[model samples]
Target: MGCSKKKIKYELSKEFQFEAAHRLIKNYSGKCINYHGHMWRVIITLHGHELDEKDMLIDFNELKPLKKWIDKYLDHTTIIWENDPMLTFFKKNNQKYFITKKSPTSEHIGEIILDKAIELFDNQRIKVKYIEVKESNTSSVKVYSNKY
Candidate 1:
């Protein structure tokens, strides 16, 4: 029994969605401004010691609640990097709405979601080992667990 618990290792992936905007600061710019959107994809990895008799760490259905909550704020919304020039322009034009203090980069977004995940789980047993964010099919970044 003791060996079983120690030998078990599993990883599960969950997908989440959020819509936002941002720009990459460039020395010479062509066209990253003009405002754009991305279909952000997040994969949350869970790691643990043992699995249930069903051979699973946790049920997939258990994630529905979190997904519902995330969808409410992330779906169809644009996120602007606070330092982006466009933000200043918008402010000068008296255009203001929902905004975040962090940059809109994939790494930044992953950190935000990871923090929320840690808060929601709040358990040392089943830990979130990594969070990977995909800005597009070709671009992605991963944030690893500090438990390293």
Candidate 2:
């Protein structure tokens, strides 16, 4: 008899892009402290051991919510650390902004996106494996789920 191996894992990924501006609030002394913008690129991966009833890990349409959320909140907006001193200025000026608990670095942004993906796709059959946030063509950060 011949030994056979069975497929046990599957993964699906989707890429999205948005435009946003941010400035590092602290722990940096570079030009990043000043406001800047990037055409952000995000790639999210889903992992599972088995396919669903439709023989698919997940329908691509199921991921549309994530893209829509990003476009609505992160695109064409300034992402600022919650405690940044400029918060008052933005509030007073009525500027479009998104507040983050941590500095708006690529690493933190990746973590935030990953968290949102988990919230939107939480299920026993599949989970968010990782999220990669590319601040620029040359710089990017990848955040992995602790459950993985």
Best by lDDT: 2
Judge candidate 2 at residue 30 and give its lDDT. Answer: 91
Encode model 1's per-residue lDDT on 46-127: one tens digit a residue. Answer: 7787676787777878667656655765666556666666667667776533455765567777777777776665365678
Q: What is the lDDT of residue 11 in candidate 1?
A: 77
Q: List the residue pairs that clash in candidate 1.
A: 20-79, 21-79
| Tens digits of lDDT, candidate 2, 27-131 | 888999999999999999999877788989999899999999999889999999998999999999999999999999999889889999999996998999999
* lDDT (C-alpha, whole model) for all candidates: 0.70, 0.92
- Kindly give the number of clashing pairs for every candidate: 2, 0
Candidate 2 segments whose C-alpha is farther than 4 A from its true place: 1-6
TM-score for each candidate, following the candidate numbering: 0.76, 0.93
lDDT of 2 at 95: 93
Candidate 1 stretches with Cα past 4 Å from truth are: 1-3, 25-31, 52-55, 83-98
